[model samples]
Target: MTEPLRWFTSSHSNNGGQCVEVADAQDHILVRDSKDPHGPALAFPASAFAAFIDGIKTGELR
Candidate 1:
C-alpha cells in the first residue's frame, strides 16, 4: 500500500500568496499550489528534484 502524502510548505515561507506545498510521494516529489490543496500537482522524480535543488544552491538555476 502507498503511504499518504504529508504536505508542507517551506519554513522560510512567509505565508505569502505565492507559496507552494510539497510532499514526498515514494519515488517522486509532488508539488502543488498552497492556495489549492485539492488541485493538480506536478511530480518530479526524486533524483531530478534533488538535482534541481542542487542547481538552485549553486545558482545554476538562475
Candidate 2:
C-alpha cells in the first residue's frame, strides 16, 4: 500500500490565507494551496524540490 500524505504548512505561516501546504510522498513532494485543501496538488521530484528550496534561500528564485 502507498503511504498517505501528511500535509503541513510552514511554521512561519501567519494564516494569511496565501500559504501553501506540503507533503512527502514516496518519491515526490506534493504541494497545494492552503485555501483549497480539496483542490488539485502539484507534484515535484524530491531532488527538484530540494533545489527549488535552495534557490529560494539563495535568492536565486527572486
Candidate 3:
C-alpha cells in the first residue's frame, strides 16, 4: 500500500530563498523544491542520502 508523504523544511530555512523540503517514505527519501510543492521530487536511496549528508559535513559537496 502507498502512503502519503509528510514533508518538512530544514530548521535552517528562514524563507530567504532557494529552500527545499524533505520527506521520508517507506524505502527512499524524497526531495523537492520549496518554491513548487506540486513539482517533481528526486528520490535517493537511504545510503546515498547518508553519503550526501556526510559530503556536506566534510565539504566534499562544494
lDDT of 2: 0.93
Task: Give candidate 2 misplaced runs (Cα > 4 Å).
Answer: 1-3
Error of 1 at 38 (Å): 0.5
The TM-score obtained by model 3 is 0.82
Put down candidate 2 lDDT per residue, 1-62, tens digits, no spaces: 76678999988888787899999987799999989999999999999999999999999999
**Lowest summed lDDT window (length 10), candidate 2:** 1-10
Instruction: Kindly report which residue pairs in candidate 2 clash with one another.
Output: none
The candidate with the higher lDDT, 2 or 3, is 2
lDDT of 1 at 61: 96
Q: Which ranges of candidate 1 are over 4 A from the true structure? A: none
Candidate 3: residue 21 lDDT (0-100): 91
Overall local distance difference test of candidate 3? 0.89
Candidate 1: tens digits of C-alpha lDDT, residues 1-62: 77789999888899675798899988999999999989999999999999999999999999
Error of 1 at 4 (Å): 2.2
Cα-based lDDT for every prediction: 0.93, 0.93, 0.89
What is the overall TM-score of model 2 with all chains considered together? 0.86
Which stretches in model 3 have alpha-carbon errors above 4 Å? 16-18
